[model samples]
Target: DLAAAPGVGVDRPRSPQPLVTAAPRADLVIWAPPDVAAALRPRAEDFGRTRGVSVTVESVSDVRSALQDVTAPESGPDVFLGPHTWLGEMEQQRVISRVTLSRNQQRRLAPKALAGARYDGQLWGVPYAIANLALVRNTDLAPQAPQTYEQLIANGRRLKAEGKVNRILLQSTGSTGDVYSGYPYLRAYGGGIFAKTPNGQYSPGRLVLDSPASLEGARRLAELGREGVIQPDVDNTNAVPLFGDRHGAYLVTGAWSVPVIQASGVPYAISPLPALPRGGKPVPLLDVDLFYVSATAQSPKLAQEFVRDCATRRDVQVRLARATGLPPALTAAYRDVAARDHHYAAWFDAGRDGDPVPSVPAMQAVWGPLGQAFADIVAGKDPQHSLTAAARQISSDLP
Candidate 1:
């Protein structure tokens, strides 16, 4: 069980039985982010035409907030798309229902992606795509991928010395700090938000941010800060453009930024972020995008069939990957698309090697304190002391 906090819901165990009820027939409606809606429209139309089931896909400005009225008959869509992070709270609120997939359907998607859809031992959605951060090198500047973080830093320094680029790495360390971007460094030094069970479930009680290895990771981060590697001013808004403009030799970003970089006409290559000299491999955070059925859906059967059958098809997954620029969660579709797009392949590879963001409600408490601690370390605060304080604050914040 996760602790309840203001603005954050607590995870509650629910009966595993599917939610099936008597209701009038309704057109299956889906609310998706603009990009996903655009991708899903044609396929949805095809499904409605062939199956004689009415389907509508709405492009929403805010995908995350679309679930606030999930139980409202007039406002709620049958299905909604969002990251797996929402599973904890939405499940707690009973706004989303469990999705039952056949054995074949389960086997069609990537294992990690399916794992992301499960919360408290029940499937909640159908994962559509996987997103993870990777190293994007400006081929014009770096020319080759560095095998390790040390070599990357060394090359960055060399490039910096020649007055060719102003920034070593174009990554966001925003005003409040970005734990998502800083996650690789933390993992490389053996620090993580929580311990995981043998089968890979996050154990909320095992908060490890203040452990010895984590403090060492923080120390290394502060060392990089003092050495002028991690800059204080660079943020999410500017990092992409600065890298596109050749202001930086390398960029640590996700696949979503690829189109902008391509539009800038900068030659780039994608690869996983390198390991540290004496630490474990740097594992980026994986965020799986899923289509969740609303618990109070008017067309529950249609929504489940569409997500489980139509949406997971190879052609549909391929089209979705094209539109979203994310690797398909479907294994065969990913292999098909990855064969043609090296960039998407790199992202998929990174996601396979990365840690899925913990979907437990306790995770909400982690972002603020850990992010602030990272910012403080970058601002030259003592790593050990700062992390200790952060850990203490997070424990207090936990329910």
Candidate 2:
């Protein structure tokens, strides 16, 4: 994971010595995913060589382990790369250092993306990428993506009558994926997950899970699932794969699936989530991941410099775009040649107008009840009862 830190110096003498040393030592260390590490290592080496700094590359297995090592006194990294949500927990624990962005640098980022990095009035991380849900449709099967919730249902019924498909794809693997994909529908129907009070506490918003609009939405979704419009195995293990395999005509997915979709050679088009039943716009849930500095690091200055380099540097942003297929967090990088040619550009455009997922600490409470509520409703439980029960649970769980 040390290799994942942006602007890690590699040019110092005995660079290879660190790798062979009994105990590895380096000017900087980073934590990130394997694929991101693989893509970043060579470039980082190049940057290090140019600057004459010796850097060591170490790969940590997962986010949790990486965070643990980075927070440990002896093994901590100078920089950590992961989701911005980590900031909420890390900041609350006083494990991360605050980063102050220049006005211009902040201006270059999407507003919602920037908001995700801000926790407790300080920006904790530099965002590398931003993603959100998009409606993907097989143009061959359905010439046009639905423009509204009603239209989507109508199209589903027509296609089912003709025996073209079985289910519309909505991810429900866990609380996170379910909320990301399902909240748009709930919001479109004029429901919200939480309400913020003047004192900064979050209250349970109107539990509209069983409202006419939510019921209408869930019923449509359940109808699709029941009529065989969706695959029977869509419980959790393989809903995404079902869509990737072309078992369904429509899916709500993020840009992360670009590689799989391309490899599958499936002909598809992207559109924003359909509008809600009352004609309100559908607001896709946007997820932003950010880079953060560890407070215990040897050099907070160096860590902040590295984050700034990662956040604003064109080369780093371009490589990030190439590696992840996610839109670069910076406006200037969005115009890079690589991003321009990617077929997912329309989805990124759609995401520009979407809503950021709630980032407050209290936001965590919304996950469990919402997931169970949706699952229960889909399993044929009474919608109003299911939603009311979930809301009560959520209210009790909120901080």
Candidate 3:
């Protein structure tokens, strides 16, 4: 008998189980950050072993390389794990197979996670971990968390003047962190990178970063940096050390930093990114990692079965939760040990209202110009001019 029951059918008697059972075996390939792989591999192996499947794990440093290997003749693994934003491009290239979720399964996921995995009206992946940016503040320095961007700026200035902190720790480096930290300001001012139609398709051509709201937000960000409230170095690596040392009062970071922060022995608290002027909420960017089956797999059926097993198994979800400080993509797993633990409880609360990052292929166009604009702003260029130029460049790059 197969160790796990099939998902589609009702429970039945075991008396008439198949006399001859096929050996359950699958290859799980992951293209993730090195730290993530180190944390998640053991749990994945244990989950596979419990189901009587032979599991093999391989790690790739980059998703592009993983995609190349999977699409190569005779080299593809049965399953792939990586960021959900890749779903849009992978679907367009027909390199991934879609997975259908039942109503129960759908309801179990955070709505933003569910929405992030859908591309062109089909669900292409199962979420493993969900991430969002938040305000990480040094408790010693910030007795009270600021509730608005204006307040953050005001408080940041006072902290800097008092020599209580080196800077506000915003990242303007050409990294994912830069985009995550910068986009919220634009959203707080009622601007967005892409607009979605009522039918759910995103129109990237309608880039609105040059709008008055976006320019104003950008100007505010630049002003904060210019006043020496924000650190001179926007490199993510540089900011981490400063934050860990409590040299900065607040830094924008994601759930991924939970373990790091705890290990650093700093007294800290996590809170929602401050709201914008006129009462709009700050929109934190969410990035989700997903599990997918390669379309070119030799045993597509078995591969999908493995995908289903990983997605619906409560035990697997719990193990994943404990292994990584990340919240499980499953709702039931939200109450598990890791989620309830002190280090992560605040992250779960902050993520409850987070926004999903745009998953359109055109999202790629925003990265280059956005990074340049942030760099220019930090270097003392006029925020309005830099943002306007970046928005025009993004519009020109849209497909």
Which candidate's TM-score is highest?
Answer: 1
Regions of model 2 farther than 4 Å from truth = 1-23, 46-51, 69-71, 168-177, 196-233, 337-339
TM-score head-to-head 1 vs 2, winner: 1
Q: Which clashing pairs does model 3 show?
A: none
What are the per-residue Cα lDDT tens digits for candidate 3 across 1-399?
111111101111112221121134244443334444555567567756886756655554554454664435346566777777676667777778988778888888877788778887788888867777778888887878888868887877788789887676554343222666677777777777776679755666677787887776777667766776554465656655668877778877776666667778888888887776666666767777788887776667756776676655666666666666667777777667544675456666667766676767777777768866776776678988888888888777777
Badly placed stretches (over 4 Å) of model 3 are 1-53, 169-177, 199-201, 337-339
**Model 3 scores what on Cα lDDT?**
0.66
User: Which candidate tops lDDT?
Assistant: 1
Segments of candidate 1 deviating more than 4 angstroms: 1-26, 69-71
User: Against the hidden true structure, what lDDT does model 1 obtain?
Assistant: 0.80
Q: Rank candidates by lDDT, best first.
A: 1, 3, 2
TM-score of 2: 0.82
